[model samples]
Target: MLAKLILRNLLHHWGSTLLSMILLSTGVGIISLLLAVNKQVEDKFNRDLKNIDLVVGAKGSPLQLVLSAVYHLDAPTGNISKEEAEKLLTNPMIEQVTPLAYGDNYDGFRIVGTDSTYLLKYNSSFSRGSMFSNPMEVVAGSNVAKKKELKIGSSFTGTHGLSKDSDDDHEHFKYVVKGILNPTGSVLDNLILTPVESVERVHSERHEHAEHEQHEEGHDEDKTTGKQITALLLTFRSPQAMFSLPRFINESTNMQSASPTLEINRLLGLLGIGMDSVKAVAATLLLVAGLSIFIALYSRLSEKKYELALIRSLGCSRMKLFTLVVSEAILLCLAGFAGGMLLGITGMYWLNEKAADEYSFTLITNNLWNKDQFLLLTGTILIGITAALIPSVKAYRLNISKTLANA
Candidate 1:
């Protein structure tokens, strides 16, 4: 009887009831998107950083080392000699190692030169052809393969530096697209990998030209300069080495080492300011939703005072009347929440598609179902009950003679 009464009461003002529902659903959808974005950012970072434990680079910002080494999103602070990196790799604390040579690009995509271990460590297998067997032989990532429209045996000259459309093109040397990696849903998905020796040779020729251009007869011929690596990724003996080795590198050598775990946290903290503000706006919207429930229910209750008086005359208890109004509020909120969720999910998929095209940041399509959303639903329903409380109390008071007389 109560459920039937509740449904009928909501149906009495179907337009207003639906308005409440719309508010709740819109609020919930916004909340869901915020939570999913945070998860996406962190998950993608971890996905690409599966193999690297320690990033050894020239002394600078730890975050810089991480961004440069792992994502190729930042310029390197400087390079380290192969000899210094090799010596560190030989340390008993280090399990395995690979050096990254950056600072070259092809059509804005970063060119990475690392040993074969980079592919082996990530377990990245080629979809076509094979890994670089010798210098100047390059393997493209899935994004590179698809974007550049290249296949095995295709040759392309790489441009200099991280920037798109570099001022200097290493026109003398062109790399053969020897292979292409299958998609790993990582930063590696966009990289072009060649031999470290190729990178060294390009810089070597540049330095020699610069000296020759100066036309200084004997400017202390730079011999110590040979193959250089932008950064080195080290695998530690155990998790303990993550902490111990960074300290060891900082204290024992002129070189700097950074742990990805620490640097990633620091970066996240810096990034959260914008995310936090957006979340705050989402929270404010939910608050407006709750207030909407309160206002809509209260306004409808005013028109029902005479009806409540008539119900009391029919022997329906005041408590039952109150429960009915509260129940109506809940129905509206729940309907709105469900509608919002469906809309939110559809929008998320579209957003992901756009982001993939515009930024190449792959977003996984997964519906959000978490504790935060559960709590949100519960809290919205509770607000509905609170909104109906005063009306319920008024029904309990009845004032049957006065209400009927006034009507």
Candidate 2:
């Protein structure tokens, strides 16, 4: 009965109630969306950076090197000589070095040329088939296999560049899908892995072929260099190496080294500023919604005073009148919260699709509700109760005879 009355009252003041709900919902949606995106982004970064102490790549922005090498979110700065990168493996402070080569793509999914260590780093195992054992054999990530419909022994040629739109297909070489990896929920889930030699072989042949064509045109020039890999992912033997190695590599070598943790933290700090600004705006909207609710309830109480008094005269308790007014506010807030959750979830789904399409990155959306959202609910309800308190108190203390005579 109380709920029905509250609903009917809100409906009677539909315009103001809707305005309040929209304001509150917009605020809640913005905050909720930020929380969801931030959580998944942090989780993805932490998961992918596991055990990776440093990244050595061609000289460029350290953040770029980390983004490209660790997350595969950008193009590599350039390629480093394989021979030069291999020298770091012999260092006493280096426990492991996984060299990565990037040059091609299949259906927008990057084909990463690294050894089995890459899979082990992500704790990935085969869901079907076996690991690549020969040149031109590849292991597909779970996403690649599912999206591209690659089966074991399936053959596909890679485009010459990292993008899906590249028309320069490597028609001379056909790569066979040797395996499909189980989902690891890391960047590996969006990559196709092959031995470093496979990438080296493809590019090497392409270089040689281009040279032969140029020679036939009477431009007798020899342009040759050693094999190169995009970057080197390194794990340190001691934590002290984290402090020493990046500086040493940047100062002493042609290649630049970046720490994933440092770069990611810096990135998050930059992102934090933008998030904080949006939160402030959202907070302002919430404040306005609270004010709107207060005004609407106060005005409605003035108009309904006589009705409230008549009910009191018929034996309705003062406490019930207070409860009735407060319940209306609660209902409005609950409706706003429900609308806000819907808006937030829809926004996340759209963002996830966009990220996957553009960067081969997807956020974990399986669990949307968390402790933070629960806090949001609590805060929203508190706003409602606080806004209605004065109006509810007025109803509780109403003079039945005076109100009736005035009416």
Per-residue C-alpha lDDT of model 2 across residues 93-155, encoded as one tens digit per residue:
999889899989987889989998888899999999999999899999999999999999999
Off by over 4 Å in 1: 1-26, 165-168, 206-225, 270-277, 307-324, 338-360, 392-405
Q: Supply the global lDDT for candidate 2.
A: 0.90
What's model 1's overall lDDT?
Answer: 0.79
Show where candidate 2 strays beyond 4 Å.
212-222
Whole-model lDDT per candidate? 0.79, 0.90
Backbone clashes under 3 angstroms, per model = 1, 0
Q: Which pairs of residues collide in model 2?
A: none
Clashing pairs in model 1, backbone N/Cα/C closer than 3 A: 21-336
Quick one: RMSD of model 1?
4.2
True-vs-predicted CA distance for residue 268, candidate 2, Å: 0.4
